[model samples]
Target: MSDSSQLPYRPCAGVMLVNQAGKVFVGQRIDSTLDAWQMPQGGIDDGEDAETAALREIGEETGIDPSLVRIVARARHELFYDLPSDLIGKVWKGRYRGQRQHWFLARFTGTDDDVKIDTDHPEFRAWKWAEPSELPAMIVPFKRKLYEDVIAEFAPWLESIA
Candidate 1:
C-alpha cells in the first residue's frame, strides 16, 4: 500500500449548527454501523468556496434551508483528521488519506420541525441536538480530535449563545 503520508487530504467544509438553546446538531451516519454522530460536513466542489460548501452541505444533509440559518463565525483555520488505516483504501476511492476541513458555526433560526433528514440522498439516519461539550465523544474515533478543535475554535461564540 502507498504511504498514507503521501496521500492528499480531501478539501471539505463542516458546520456546527447551534440552536437558540446553544445545542449543536449531530447526525448518525447512514453508512456507519458504529454509534458515531457528526455535524454536517462534506467535500468542497470545484470552484466552490468553503463557506458556500458548508451551507450547501447543511442543506443537503439536513434538508435545512440556507435562509433558516445565520452564519455566526468560522474557525480561525482549517482543521484536519486522518482516516484510520483500515479505512484508508475503502473510502473516497483511496484518493485521500483524510480530510482538511474549513468549519463554520451557524445559528439555526428555525425550530426542530425545520430539520428533515430524509433528503433525496440522505446521509443521516437519525439526528439530534447535542451539548457542545459532548461533540468529541459522539463522533467516530478518528475524528474526535477534529471535533475537539472545532468546539475550541467556536468556544467564544458558543459561550455567548449559552
Candidate 2:
C-alpha cells in the first residue's frame, strides 16, 4: 500500500488507554462479523479539536468518560489505502484518497470496574488489558505498521504511565 503522504489522506486519531496494572486496553469490535479488535479512534471533525476528538472517540467506543483518562503522549502515523470512490465521507468527497491517523496514549485514572463496555453505538463487545507490544496484530493490516510506530515512540512514557 502507498503511504498516505503519497495519496490524499484524512487526519485522524486513535487513543490507547492504559490502567495501573500496566496493561493496555484492547477492544473487540461488536458489529464486524469478523470480530476485529482495535483501539478507540475516529476522524477529526471540523470545528472540533484533535484532542477533543480522541477523548470523544474513546468514550464513544469504550463508554469510558474522558475525565477518567490522562493524556500521556501522541504519535502520528499515515497509511495509504484505497477508499472506493463512493465510500469516502463528505469531508473527502471529490478527491478523497485515504486516511492519516495520529494516535494518542492515555492512562486511565479509574479502576477496572469503571469501564463501561456498552454504549448507544458500541464498536466494542469486550475489552481486556493486554501488553502494549502485542497490540499491532489486533489492528487491521493496513494500520498495523502505524500502530507499531506509535507504540515504539511512546514505549517509555507508557511504561511510566503504568
Candidate 3:
C-alpha cells in the first residue's frame, strides 16, 4: 500500500450557507450510506480562486444560484482534515490524504423554494437548514473538527445577523 503520509492534501473550497433565520445548510450525501451531512463543498479547479470555487460548489451541490446568496465572511486560514486510514486509498483515486480547505460563510437570500438539490449532478440525497451549533454533530467524524473551526471563525458574523 502506498504510504498515506506521502500523499498531498486536496485543495478544496467549502461554504457554510446560512439563511436569514441563522440556520445553516447541511446535506446528506448521495454517495454515503451513513447519516453524514455536510455543507456545500468540493475540490477547487485549477486556476479558480477559493471564493469562486466556493460559489460554484454551492450552485453545483445545492442548485442554488449565486445570486440567491451573499458572501459574508471567510475563515482566516485554511483548515486541514485527514481521511480515515481505511478510506485513504479508496477515495479521490488515492491521490489525497485528505483535504486542505478554504471555507466561506454565505447568507442565503432566497426563500426555501429556491433550493433544488436535484441538479445536473446532485451530491446530496436530502438537505436541510440546521442550527449552526449542530454542524459538528451533523458532519462525518473525520470532518467534525474542521466544521467546528469554521463555526468558530464565522461565529461573530453568524451572531450579528441572528
Q: What lDDT does the true structure give each of the candidates?
A: 0.95, 0.76, 0.93
Q: Which has the higher lDDT value, candidate number 1 or candidate number 3? A: 1
Between candidates 2 and 3, the one scoring higher on TM-score is: 3
Give the total clashing residue pairs for model 3. 0
TM-score of each: 0.98, 0.81, 0.98
RMSD in Å for all candidates? 0.7, 4.1, 0.7
For residue 63, give model 1's deviation from the true position in Å.
Answer: 0.3
Tell me how many residue pairs clash in candidate 2.
Answer: 0
Candidate 1 local Cα displacement, residue 75, angstroms: 0.7
Q: What is the per-residue lDDT of model 1 for residues 1-162, given as tens digits with 9 covering 90 to 100?
A: 889999999999999999989999999999989999999999999999999999999999999999998888989899999999999989999999999999999999999999999999999999999999999999988899999999989998997864
Best by lDDT: 1
CA displacement after TM-score superposition, residue 97 of candidate 1 (Å): 0.4
TM-score of 3: 0.98
- Per-residue lDDT of 135-154 in model 3, one digit per residue for the tens? 99989999999999999999
- 1-162 in candidate 2: lDDT tens per residue? 333334467767778888998888888878666545787888889888778999999888888888899998876444334555444453355345666777788989998778788888877889898888888888766667767777787787876897
